[model samples]
Target: MQFLAALLLQADGTDLTRPDLTINYIIIGVLLVVAAVLSVIVVRRRMQERDDDWE
Candidate 1:
């Protein structure tokens, strides 16, 4: 989490006038997005496993 936080904040110290700023935003956006995706995957897998045990 802290690593993500640092990555998220990494842009704050940089000047947006550079082209890399745009790329950084894209990377951070992707990271945040994948976090949601992975969380959903985990919950779904856990539920499926639990359901299978009930049989």
Candidate 2:
């Protein structure tokens, strides 16, 4: 994974550790959190709707 990240950074010719990229990192973090919350909600709803006999 580290190698892949380094390769991508080299391809883009930009360092992600720069201060200017902070907003981009923040946006990505927020999107990931939102996706995780949505996924958990969908999974719990689906589980609740299933027949209890399977458990």
Candidate 3:
């Protein structure tokens, strides 16, 4: 399994020079930002609910 993985990686030449690498990075970054925003919204909403329960 390891041998086949290594063979595949070698067949691709260098890692950084791949044209699609930048697009992949951009996609990952956008996903992270969206996740963070959603997380913040959920936490804030939960906090509001908790505060209201204390009234």
Give the best candidate by lDDT: 3
Give the alpha-carbon lDDT of every model: 0.89, 0.86, 0.92
Off by over 4 Å in 3: 1-19
- lDDT value, residue 46 of candidate 3: 100
Model 3 agreement with the true structure over 1-55: per-residue lDDT tens digits: 9999999998888763656688888999999999999999999999999999999
In model 2, which residue pairs have backbone atoms overlapping below 3 Å? none
Against the hidden true structure, what lDDT does model 1 obtain? 0.89
lDDT of 1 by residue, 1-55 (tens): 9999888787686744545578888999999999999999999999999999999
Range of the 10 consecutive residues with the lowest summed lDDT in candidate 1: 11-20
Clashes of 3: 0
The TM-score, computed over Cα atoms with residue i paired to residue i, of candidate 1 is: 0.55
Candidates' TM-scores?
0.55, 0.58, 0.66
How high is the lDDT of residue 43 in model 1?
100
- Give residue 46's error in model 1 in angstroms: 0.4
lDDT of 2 at 33: 100
Residue 17 C-alpha lDDT in model 3: 63
In model 1, where do residues sit more than 4 Å from their true spots?
Answer: 1-20
Query: Whose lDDT is higher: candidate 1's or candidate 2's?
Result: 1
Worst 10 residues of 2 by lDDT: 13-22
